[model samples]
Target: MSLRYKSAEESRVVISELMLPSHSNFSGKIHGGYVLSLLDQIAFACASKHSRAYCVTASVDTVDFLNPIEVGELVTMRASINYVGRTSMVVGIRVEAENIQTGIVKHCNSSYFTMVARDDEGKGIEVDGLLLENTTEIKRFLKAVKRIEMKRKRREEFDREDFVPEDYLSDLENYKVKVTCTDEL
Candidate 1:
């Protein structure tokens, strides 16, 4: 079978919602959970558009809340396919909040969601490859590749049978934690 290809633009999705008082936290700022739910929804839409199959979020890589969003502001989320593997696509999402009266915008957060395409039988299926048209698209794809490699390395090193916690104890010396183990080596 011939391999299908799709441009990054074809999978882009944008959504805007007005933050309400009901979505606010005790501090009167918009709840982070509500924003995260919107991000996941947009990621799903973009992934499904590109893959043309049912997609599920495999993991959420990075969710850095840069700024606090206030209630009554309009929140906008933009999502696009950053990188594509056989059956997985990394969807990058950028969130911004705008004050309707002041016409000022602030970047709220940025995140990456890894989604896997599945067939009707609930089996993983191959999806279309990405056709990068510009330098920005290429850069995003490379960044996603680097993130995946780093994650794999971390998992391999920490999830091994030969892993020793004492070896990493010195690495945490600058942290705010006290190690209290009764058993001796």
Candidate 2:
């Protein structure tokens, strides 16, 4: 009967774990894929906390690995709902790593996961709107709106009925890639 709203603070989730040797890649740094798994988990927790429903990750909007995390470092991830639609919410996550001995910290990653609330029958369910309490929250919500619009426009531009590969061939000339066309192609 009435619209419901929840604040970003209410949806916040934070977790910290020590990077272990088992989680390291061949080069001895923490694996990005492992970090991604953690990010997805936190996103789900934050979204579910906000909506009070089970949520599934519809898409990973962005993942920027700014720094490599090393084994033996303390990794912390913070997730919060940045935007909320009728059935979906964008969870913003920031990852940081700290060197225990030196007390040095570095930002490891920033990511956004779009999650959709689902019911028992796997149907999409309505979620409460975001309650923006401060300028920071307002900015994040606006940025999410812009990102959605940009993604829509990108899809339309690439999936146009008259799309032609040849038209974009020149666009790739500046890259280091070399294109070879087969007779059948």
Candidate 3:
């Protein structure tokens, strides 16, 4: 079978919603969970559009809330395929909030979601590769590749059979926790 390639622009998704009081937390700011839900929705849409198959979120790599979103601001989220594997794609999402009256926009959060396409039988299916058009798209794809590699290395190193907790004790010296298992050690 021939390998299929899709451009990043073909799978891009953008959504805007007005933040309401219902979406706010006790402190009156828009809740982080609400923002995360929007991010997931856009990620799924972008991944599904790229693969033309049902996609499921396998992992969320990073969700850094850089700025607080106000209830009255309009929140816009943009998602596009950053990288694609045989059966999975990494969707990068950027969230920004705009004050309608002031015409000012603030970047609120950025996240990366790993989504895997599945067939009707619920089996993983191969997805189309990304066709990077510009330097920015190329850089995003490379960054996703590096993130995946680093995550794999971290898991392998931490889950090794010969892992020793004591060896990492000194690394936590500046942390707030106090180790109290001296007798057990």
Candidate 4:
């Protein structure tokens, strides 16, 4: 069979939901966990649309919450295929919250989810290649590539048998941690 390709627009998914009182946390703001759930849902939708198959989340590579969302606000999430590999795709999501009363919108979070397509038997399957059509799409794809490389390097460095905690101890000197068990470590 010939290889299939798709533009990011073909798989883009956008969802908007009203934040309810039940979605608020102790601080009276929408709980972060609730937002994460919506992000994952959109990511799955986008990936499945792109591959035309069942997809499973391989990882939540990044989630940055820039602003707090409040109850009674309208939360909108936009998801698109940012990068595609043999069997996996990186889904980029942008979240925003709009205060209905004020009509002001705030960027709440930006996230990246890695999803892998699966066949009927649940084995990983090849996904269609991404056709970058514009500069923004190209940039998103490139950023995903860099993020994957950085994550791989971080895992390799920390998982090495010769890894040393002391080597990175000094790197945290400026942080707020006290390191109470430094001697034990």
Model 1: which residue pairs collide? Answer: none
Q: Quick one: RMSD of model 1?
A: 1.0
- Misplaced by over 4 Å in model 3 are 182-185
Q: Which window of ten consecutive residues has the lowest lDDT sum in model 3?
A: 176-185
TM-scores for every predicted model: 0.97, 0.94, 0.96, 0.94
lDDT per residue (tens digit) for residues 1-185 in model 4? 78999999999999999999999999999999999999999999999999999999999999999999999999999999999999999999999999999999999999999999999999999999999999999999999999999999999999998887888989989999977665545
Off by over 4 Å in 1: none
Clash pairs, candidate 3, are: none
Ranking by TM-score: 1, 3, 2, 4
Q: What is the lDDT of candidate 3?
A: 0.95
Q: Name model 4 segments beyond 4 Å from true.
A: 178-185
Writing each residue's lDDT as its tens digit, candidate 2 over 90-179 gives 999999999999999999899999999999999999999888999999999999999999999999989998777787888999999888
- Model 3, 1-185: lDDT tens per residue? 89989999999999999999999999999999989888999999999999999999999999999999999999999999999999999999999999999999999999999999999999999999889999999999999999999999999989997788788899889999888876445
Q: How far is 151's C-alpha from truth in model 4 (Å)?
A: 0.5
What is the Cα-based TM-score of model 1? 0.97
Q: In candidate 2, which residue ranges exceed 4 Å CA deviation?
A: 182-185
Give the better candidate number (3 or 4) by TM-score: 3
